[model samples]
Target: MTGQPLDAGTIAELPKVLLHDHLDGGVRPSTLLELSDAQGLVLPADDAEGLASWFVTSAAAGSLEAYLATFDRTLAVMQSADALRRIAREAVEDLAADGVVYAEQRYAPELHVSGGLEPQQVVDAVTEGVEEGVAAAAGAGRRIRVAQVLTAMRTGGNAADVARLALENRLRGVLGFDLAGAEAGHPPSRHAAAFRTLRYASFPVTVHAGEAAGAGSVAEALHIAGAIRIGHGVHVIDDVVLGEPTEDDPWGVEKARFGDIAHWVRDQQVPLEVCPTSNVHTGATPSIAQHPVTPLLRLGFAVTVNTDNRLMSGTSLTQELAALVEHAGWTRDDLRDVTLTAAWNGFIHHDERAELVEDVIIPGFTERSNGRHRA
Candidate 1:
């Protein structure tokens, strides 16, 4: 894969797979304004551009707790079934426009019950919206697949119930389960029973760990909570010990030694749903250039790039990849590798994942490069 660095336009045309996107966090600013107006709720900004800028500024508060506070506004208008359905449908449409071939939308159903909605009703509304979004995208000549991953807030007390909801809807559209929220005081181990239930039922689980905390948080997510994938697991790099660079290797990655947790993560090929821009905004990492995604990828840690929250970060998957190419000196091969990693690690069944990689992702990249690289 040798040529000029891929620009954002080229990256936007490549088929990509997303594994870690928040439904509430990705609501369109214009939609938010409309919903808030219908509810007679005051907002910091009156227009879409200002509202979008406000979210980006608020999310860059340099702490997970402060960064998460911006969601109060998004969640404020997302209480009713109609709002959830609209937001979910628009999310799929936006991703399709951005050239995402597959995506898994995640949100905590318990958060939407304040408007007198049952958890099952919330799921039904979102599922309906996803179906509609898929059909709409297909009509517009954009083929995409969207699935749901039911999330349980780590600080909330209803994780067990969320797990049950995921199992009940597995055949419908729910593909997996997740635990998200403040990762410091609320560890994944706190919801042991929820993990136990999901594990006993042979369900896939991904835990948000090693973001606000360190590698210890990642260990608990993997060992105690039985997560097959780690969300924002950048801090797993904390356990690595960097050694001196050798004459043959200037980057020193060959000399870097991994601790027990890091070794296990790499050895078992546990997928890391890394959000580069979101990590910078939340102070999880310093910047895109210094992000551990590159190093971890070089060390064979199964690193996959994602847009954790598209609106909050003021970004899309294309922009995320372009940033790596511009600031991190990433090449076309790096982009392909991460896209393939994400496709293979998606929550769907093994055969479906293979079809996505073989039929969609590889062909898209191959055609774009004009046979410059072989998959």
Candidate 2:
């Protein structure tokens, strides 16, 4: 069944699984202002509202590198252990409040050590914050689980170090490793050593590819670097050749021809962590209505919705799904399917992922569906 379209409030209450949120990108505006003032950092906007507006405006620069430049301010303030902890804690608490039952928040440890804090110290501080946020959210009647995915900047030559850190803290709070940054010139193979280290240890790895670049970057991420999940894989659409639409199929997804990489990705069911609004902001896609997410989803790809950056995109997970519903015609079943796919592909163990799906996600959707029917 296609199911009915869900309103924003109902969508907000649905149990969500977020697999690709950035820790630094979701910092509270007020917190950024307060921290910037404390650190004598000159921010473009003094007030929280102005700063929030500035982020959204600046991030809509129509390119990934330009979009990433906005992080300088956020990263500048995130040098201290206290700032990292506070940001991480607030990220978890915010996700929990938005009805996220499980999330993997990612950040590069190397970026946060500019203030002389060791990489290990950075992880420790964020872990403490995550624990605090989980406890606080539970106390507030919003139970959520959050895990860290240590990321290495593709240009930073420390992927191996980050992979080691993630492996060392696998049981602590870290669950995965990732490579993120400008995707144009820097391909995933640049960090092959790190991906190899993680793969040898059986650690989950997701690579940022096919966003600024094209499908070749995605192929390298999968074949060379061995990433289990692809971040912002919107450009994989380039490899797909669409056929003429007919009466039976409007989008022509059934008749579309997939290139080898696309066929492998779909046949193997590799999850794509798609951030709709963020894609628009980075000019990865023209707009939400025209985004490749809908076509990719209809084509039977393992697609999951995410808010890559809440502050920059001015979005939450709820808003991201709502946009898809309104602009892309996503229904309740579409939401449920993507949610289940995300839960199934989570970096957690098989049993834990099953528990999240069976115990949390499925029940949450069923309850909401029933409530709507009764109403």
Candidate 3:
């Protein structure tokens, strides 16, 4: 294959890694509609397309504030244990069909107890759903492994409660911890005690910073919370500056200056979970074409592409990667590099992560681009 943008079909068939998907946010339109109706929940739109369009428009209101409000509908329906189970199982099925070989999906359990369930109940339901989903994928001739990342709403209370819940279930498919929800006023340092607890437990953490706020939030997430990865570290690009160059360096390749926080993220190879469509919806970036995915990749940053919310942003990992190739001018080999980076940064056992990078990921990309070869 030449160094051109791959079509949607080709992108859909390649093995993919997704690190930032939200479990409740990725529900299918039809499923959401049906679930709402079953629970006697009224919606603004009657048909599935109309409801989906409503969500996309609402989430695209040019501010992270409005974008996050779109979750109110989805979260309301996830109150019951059964509802959580069904959505999670279906999410994994959808991921497998979309060529997601491995995924780390996150959701806040605190959002699910309004219907009279305990915190641990929500975790168990989600864990069971993940197991069923993996089995469903295998029965369909695809093997997919999924890990749950429990999210603690920054605007809500008692993050240490959520952190303890995630640690309790870590032996049961719960892999990591996150601080999601509104990022404006709720700095990660607000939950310093929870981070300290998780750190003592040696659990991997990914904080949602630098998307709604600036580099300061990212710094707190790293230093205070001990974040191994970031959810949408887009604003770190603000610290970068490189005016045009002259002479033999006509490529405009001056040093891309970074702040102390940015320097640590880059030098430590802390992965950034970038969602192109979601970023555009929240006005985090201008256009999908202008997303920093490829620039960070070429600059030696461990950048991995993701779909923050398939329902809200209306995208998959394959679609995100395809957009990068089409609009960002990335090559097929570049896609492979990003996939490997995601697998490495994934919150999983070291042996399992290594197996994915060595066995499944590299071989699938090799087969897709160059076809079968001699031994």
Candidate 4:
């Protein structure tokens, strides 16, 4: 039931769930310019549009390390409570305007402490910002839910501290814990203590894997680190070997094969937060069409679409969905399915998840789908 590509209006009206966004990575360009000025920092581009282009182009350098280098500029400006709070609030407002009903935004508190602020202080500031943004969005007639996901840098040695902080603040809007950084040499096992802590506390965990590395990284994330979800587990495709169809089987029912890792991921129904544009920007795949998400979805692996970094990828949830609709021939049903997958896999409570599925996602997509049909 493939439908026509989603238009901007319909895309903007569709309710979405974002499970893998980065708070620091999605700062508003205009806000960055202002923050940079306040900090007396020099920016590569003078204007917001130019800075936006610069970020997109630099991220498109086709390597994770090169892509991460762009964060130096953003991180530099995000050292103070005011900057963090303002950016975090802006993130919530922007997501709400783009029709995101719920989001789990992640960032490393340790990265923001260079300005003589403590880790808890940084978290407190961002949380207050998110709360303020949510209230402001409500006053603007947009209802949205957002939670912070405290992230531990895989290259750093503070995973345990980060994990403990996340646990300590879970009641205050910190929904989960995650590991993010350069993924090649720094494996999830490097943060085993943090994952162990989360596991002991029964907290949710997601780790970036298979984006910069391969199936082994994902395997460690699942087996060693006990991650409930995988961030860009695209390279799990590397473990899959598609078989050939025969005359006896016209439908190719037995033509697809999976290695143990892929089989485990699929059988376990571990959600893959697939960020298409960002995957392309990081060279995880050559293009949107070549991304493993469609194949994984068809094979019954739990898959959810996300915009990993709105600024870096120059995308929104709407843009990410539109890209898949245009390039992958995804129908509106496919979009709904991925939204449901994300809502289900979100780090929020089960009752809230059910409420979102019933009260927002399902009904919102249904309305849009019906409107398209009537038109």
Candidate 5:
């Protein structure tokens, strides 16, 4: 293959790394129907396709609040350990099928404890499911690695407890901690205690900021909460200012300016876990063509594409890449760049990160390019 923009099929075959996926949000629609039926719960649609369409449409309701309300039905079906395990396992299988070599999926264990299981039990069940899924996929000739990121809802009071849970299970596939859910009024500072605890324990933390809010939310996530990666940080573009084109550079190439927050994020090499389809669904952008990904990538920000909620976005990592290829005009090299960035920023050990790049990513891309590897 030449150094050209990759088509959808070729893009699907390339190795990928995902850092911002959600376990609850990526549940299979068929699995949701099965779980709902087993629990005698009434769903908006009785069939899988209809249910999937419903989730996608409802999430496009133009506001983050409306977008998040769709999770109520999803969360309702996740009360049992068996349900959670199945969801986790199937998530791995789906991602592996899409050629994901590494993933760190997140979910709130506290949310799954409503049926009387302890938080630790929830973690163990999901971890077991991940391990089982990886083995099953490996049996079928697909190699993948998966880790868990325990999440604490920003509106809830169990963040510190969840942080401790993450530490307890660090050796058992738990990778890091995250603060998810509504981000407007429930700022990261609200969970300062949890951040302080995780910081003291030397645990890595990612915060959901600048999605439902503005750049200040990102600042609090960094300064107040000490987040290393930001989930859906599209709003950080609010801090970036672009000047009018001049005669010397008609596109204003050198006139783009970054505010203090954006400057810090870029200079510090902080990763922004950007989910293009999910961002459009949440009204962060009207469409993929209008997303700031192109400019952000050109501006040299550490941007890594992701599938934040596959079910909600009705997407796969491949679909996300394809959309960028078509709409944002991203090339094979651009996809490779972001995949490498994600692998580096992944919440794994340094040796594992190096191995992923040196072994899986580079080799896969090289094979796809017919041994004409990029320098």
Candidate 6:
């Protein structure tokens, strides 16, 4: 599940699903260059490759705080409704081209208000963008569907407002609510009211925990915040028991009889959005070879791989899969399995999602694995 250089044609034709990518974090570097230029905002870099490297260096190779700071630049130019809509549309278009059949893109709307666009306008722009992008994809025979996950920055004081915005758009393309930001100081408990409000509305929710923080933060996300999905739950390994290697089981260890909060998450089938490259860049894990995702996958956890920030991480879902396959020793079957699991576990309608699994995602991958989908 770590590093694979799969055939480019295979990757392009294979159906994929993404659940944890950030709307602001996945912007096209060229789009960033053009938008920032019009806004008279000088970037840390000028060209696409430089801008792309700048994002990865800032996000993957930087500290958690520094990784987050990269968003400020993207959000700064996305204040206007037009800008937000354009970026969202293009985000979907780009994902579709990468062979993504479904993606649930999340963003903290609190950061995009310099132009005084109302919170509703932010949701509207994103939903409109999805519609347009889906149409464009259909025209190209890619066929992609997207849902927006509205995130409230736990460090920001607008959790309640963001929660409201997510609720308002639930009837539209908004599928869930989430709290994202610095996981250390800003725990999910800090936004108890926002979680409570969302709960009252009977809305589904996911939380970005266990990345910057460990077991304690994950506990609060599930127990207090009702997070059905975990964003970057790589730190779940912290609670696991790993003993010395032995003969019978080369990896001699026990699933701690005393299950930690993270174990409960896996045992209970809560999906972890495992972004391998982003995890490495942020020092969430020491190396892709040692990523907790491989172990988690073996343990039968609902582990779904993703590119948490394509632009910032300098990766695509295909690259993420390739990395996992080549480095992590994942086979073609393993790739299809993860894609299917992600398709099932993503925040979409049960009926629509069922169709996605049986029709688009499963069929495409299944046919490919069997050589039937190959052209």
Query: How displaced is residue 5 in candidate 2, in Å?
Result: 0.9
Provide backbone clash counts, one per model.
Answer: 0, 0, 0, 0, 0, 11
Per-residue alpha-carbon lDDT of candidate 6 for residues 42-125, written as tens digits (9 for 90 to 100): 999999999898888778654677788788888888898888889999999999999899999898777777799878888888
Candidate 2, superposed: residue stretches over 4 Å from native: 372-375
> Against the hidden true structure, what lDDT does model 3 obtain?
0.86
Ranking by lDDT: 2, 1, 4, 5, 3, 6
- Misplaced by over 4 Å in model 1 are 1-4, 245-250, 371-375
Estimate the lDDT of model 4.
Answer: 0.89
What tens digits encode model 3's per-residue C-alpha lDDT throughout 1-375? 735567778888888899999998998888889999998989889898999999999999999989989888998889888889999999999999999999998999888999999999999899888889999999998879999999998998869999999999888989999999788778888888999999999999999988978878888888888999999998777666644646643323355666787778889988999888999999988888677665566567788889999999877888888888787677787888888889988998889999998888878877777754211
TM-score of 6: 0.94
Best-performing candidate as measured by TM-score? 2
Provide the TM-score for each candidate, comma-separated: 0.97, 0.97, 0.95, 0.95, 0.96, 0.94
Task: Put down candidate 2 lDDT per residue, 1-375, tens digits, no spaces.
Answer: 339887899899999999999999999999999999998889999898999999999999998888999999899999999999999999999999999999999999999988999999999999999999999998998878888999999888999999999999999989998899987778777788888888899999899988888999989999988999999898999999988878776678888999999999999999999999999999989999999999999999999999999999999999999999998889999999999999999988999999999988888898888784211
* lDDT of residue 350 for candidate 2: 93
Candidate 5 root-mean-square deviation in Å:
2.3
Error of 5 at 285 (Å): 1.0
Give the lowest summed-lDDT range of ten residues in model 4. 245-254
Per-residue accuracy of model 5 over 1-375 as CA lDDT, tens digit each: 545888888888899999999998999999999889988999999999999999999998888888888888889988878888888999999999999999999999989888988999999889889988999889878989999999999999999899999999999999899999888679877788889988998889999998889888988999999999998788888998867867654434477988999998889988999999998888888999878877778788899999989999899999999999998778989999999999999999999999999999988898888944222
Residue 173 local lDDT, model 2: 80
Looking at model 1, which ten-residue stretch has the lowest summed lDDT? 366-375
Query: Which residue ranges in model 5 land beyond 4 Å of their true spot?
Result: 245-253, 371-375
Model 4, 198-243: lDDT tens digits are 8999999999999989998999989988999999999988888755
Candidate 1 per-residue lDDT, tens place, 185-267, comes to: 88777789999999999999999999889999999999999999999999999999866767665446888998999999999
Instruction: Give the whole-model CA lDDT for all candidates, comma-separated.
Output: 0.91, 0.92, 0.86, 0.89, 0.89, 0.83
